[model samples]
Target: MQFSIATPTAAEFAALYLETGWGQWPLETFERALAGSWVVCVARDDDNRLVGLGRLIGDGALHAFVTEMIVSESARGAGIGAEIVRRLVGEAHRRGVRDVQLFAARGRAAFYERNGFARRPDDAPGMEWAGESRGTAVP
Candidate 1:
């Protein structure tokens, strides 16, 4: 299986989101959010079908966060996810982002660990705002 990385347009990103069951976000919503992104990476198979996507968002210098990292179920074990993360990290580093972060779901920690991420101390907890808006609020 051949893999290649490219920056995706808003429509492409939204399609990948739906395919991966990340959420049901519309193209307009994706366009608005992607416009603020520092970079977006998409991994595709030889046939040019999108298999994975990840994004880095921030002020384009000091900090960035990885979001929407996902791979299609059919492509999960083919290392596409790792490639997506690797590409996103490379892009963030190239932009001189001093800090990059991502919130991995439970059972997915090992995946990030393999990509050079270390688990933070338990004392430093991860928090989120559970609501329809999906806006993370600090408690």
Candidate 2:
């Protein structure tokens, strides 16, 4: 697989998301998310299929959140997702961002640990404002 910071179309992104069993979302939502991202990294197979994708979102220099690290079902266990996370984190550091964070999917802490992330202290202060208008977006 080849990895690069180039982005894929929203259609391709949504398709890859679906391929991961994450269900479906509108292409425009994907488009807006891509447009607002600080950076996007993609991994493609030999045939140039969109097999993996990762995004870094935040101010370019001081903070970044690594989100949507995705690898197609067929491409899982091949290190594509890990490499994508590495690249995103590297890009954040390269930009001098000292605050980097990511929300790991449930039961996926081991994967993040392998990618050089540690658990936040149990007492770390954080909260969610899950208001009625909030929408669900997870993978």
Candidate 3:
């Protein structure tokens, strides 16, 4: 697998995002979001097909968080996800971002831990603004 990570063009990013079930946003919305992100990393296979993606968003200094990490179902378990995280963290470091963070889904904490992320007891709770009901609510 000849893979590479780079900042994807807006169109390429939107295309891969749709492939990963983020089709709710219109193309224009995707373009806007892509332009606003501090950094976006895409993983491509030997054939140059996009197999994974991740993005970082925050002010240019002091804070940043990795988000939207997704790998094509067929590409899972092949270290593509790890590569994306590695690249994203590298980008943050290069930018001199002071606080890089990511929220792992349940049961996936070990994966991030392996990548050098530690649980933070001093961090405040995080929240999300869901635009639509997903049959759940915060306590």
Please tell me which predicted candidate would have the highest lDDT against the true structure. Answer: 2
Query: What is the C-alpha lDDT profile of model 2 across 5-93, one tens digit per residue?
Result: 88899999999988888778888999998999998999999999999999988986556777788889888999998899878876766
Model 1 agreement with the true structure over 50-121: per-residue lDDT tens digits: 778777777775667776687888888988888877777666665565466777787887788787666666
**Residue 57 in model 1: lDDT:** 77
lDDT of 1 at 123: 83
Model 2 compared with the native: what TM-score? Answer: 0.85
What is the lDDT for 135 in model 1? 27
Q: Which has the better lDDT: candidate 2, or candidate 3?
A: 2
Q: Model 3, range 1-139, lDDT digits (tens) per residue?
A: 5444456666777777777776666777778877778888877777887788888898876667877787887788999888878777777666766467777776876777777676656455432221122223323
Q: In angstroms, how far off is 47's CA in candidate 1? A: 1.6
Worst 10 residues of 1 by lDDT: 127-136
Structural RMSD, model 2: 9.1
RMSDs, each prediction? 8.4, 9.1, 9.9
lDDT of 1 at 60: 71
TM-score of each: 0.79, 0.85, 0.76
Off by over 4 Å in 3: 1-5, 126-139
Residue 73, candidate 1: C-alpha displacement in angstroms: 1.1
